[model samples]
Target: METEKQYVIRCGNGYVRFNLDGSMIGCKYKSSKTTESHMKRLPFNIDLAVASGIIKIEEAE
Candidate 1:
């Protein structure tokens, strides 16, 4: 990515920008907002039945 592009940092997370020499340009602790909506997301489906002949992938999708 280009350095001119803006970036965002999240809470409990930080970013390390690298330079062309493969060195860290700088490190910054970004303050990103957390929404409860994200927490409400369910885990990915990994049921064997879905992959087997029981259910179709379209149904899971």
Candidate 2:
């Protein structure tokens, strides 16, 4: 079976993963200062991330 396309964005203390449809898959934070609440405050949308230079659209292998 073919695998679904995915994307990723490396943030300050972690990374955010996304599906090809621009929906968020999940996020991971490495620092104690970073939390789900903080991540929630940031834009996770693919288009918004691109517009803000937060990430590029590249298929993850």
Candidate 3:
């Protein structure tokens, strides 16, 4: 089995992380300081969101 590395991007007061293949895996809420917050997957790509001025992606470490 292959495990692709995940990527995290800043969103609002929280964060959204997706797989290298662009699948949303998990997220966190700023209020509870937990990554277990459930979120809806966007119909478009995260990269596309950045390109289209929908969201800004933060630099990943």
lDDT of each: 0.31, 0.48, 0.47
Scored by lDDT, model 1 comes in at 0.31
Model 1 regions more than 4 Å off:
1-4, 8-12, 31-61
Clash count, candidate 3: 0
Clashing pairs in 2: none
Model 1 Cα lDDT, one tens digit per residue, 1-50: 63232433121234333333433333354322222232223143324433
Write the number of the candidate with greater lDDT, choosing between 2 and 3: 2
Residues 1-61 of candidate 2 have per-residue lDDT tens digits of 9644444456544666544444554466422222333334554544676678775443444
Which residue pairs clash within candidate 1?
none
lDDT, residue 15, model 3: 68
Q: What C-alpha lDDT, on a 0 to 100 scale, does residue 35 get in candidate 3?
A: 22
Say which prediction, candidate 2 or candidate 3, comes out ahead on TM-score: 3
Report the poorest 10 consecutive residues by lDDT, candidate 3. Answer: 30-39
* Per-residue lDDT of model 3, residues 1-61, tens digit only: 9543333456655665654445654466422221212222444555577777654554334
In order of lDDT, best first, we have: 2, 3, 1
